[model samples]
Target: MIMIRVILIMLFGRCLSCAICSTFHGWIKKWIQIS
Candidate 1:
């Protein structure tokens, strides 16, 4: 059970980081376009 929970947390963290990275990438692209 504990192992399952740890795996879930790791997956969640990876997904969250991916989302944040994509958002940051989009924002940078917009900023570059504006400039």
Candidate 2:
């Protein structure tokens, strides 16, 4: 049970980071387009 919880936490963290990275990428693209 502990192991499962740990795995889930890691997966959630990875997904959150991915979302942040994609958002940043989009922001940069929009910035470039506007400039």
Q: Clashing residue pairs in candidate 2, if any?
A: none
Distance from true position, residue 2, model 2, in Å? 40
Model 2 per-residue lDDT tens digits across residues 1-35: 99967865776567756776567557768999999
lDDT of 1 by residue, 1-35 (tens): 99967865776567756876567557768999999
* Stretches of model 2 off by over 4 angstroms after superposition: 1-17
Q: Estimate each model's TM-score.
A: 0.51, 0.51
**Each candidate: what lDDT?**
0.71, 0.71
Clashing residue pairs for model 1 = none
The local lDDT score (0 to 100) that residue 27 gets in candidate 2 is: 76
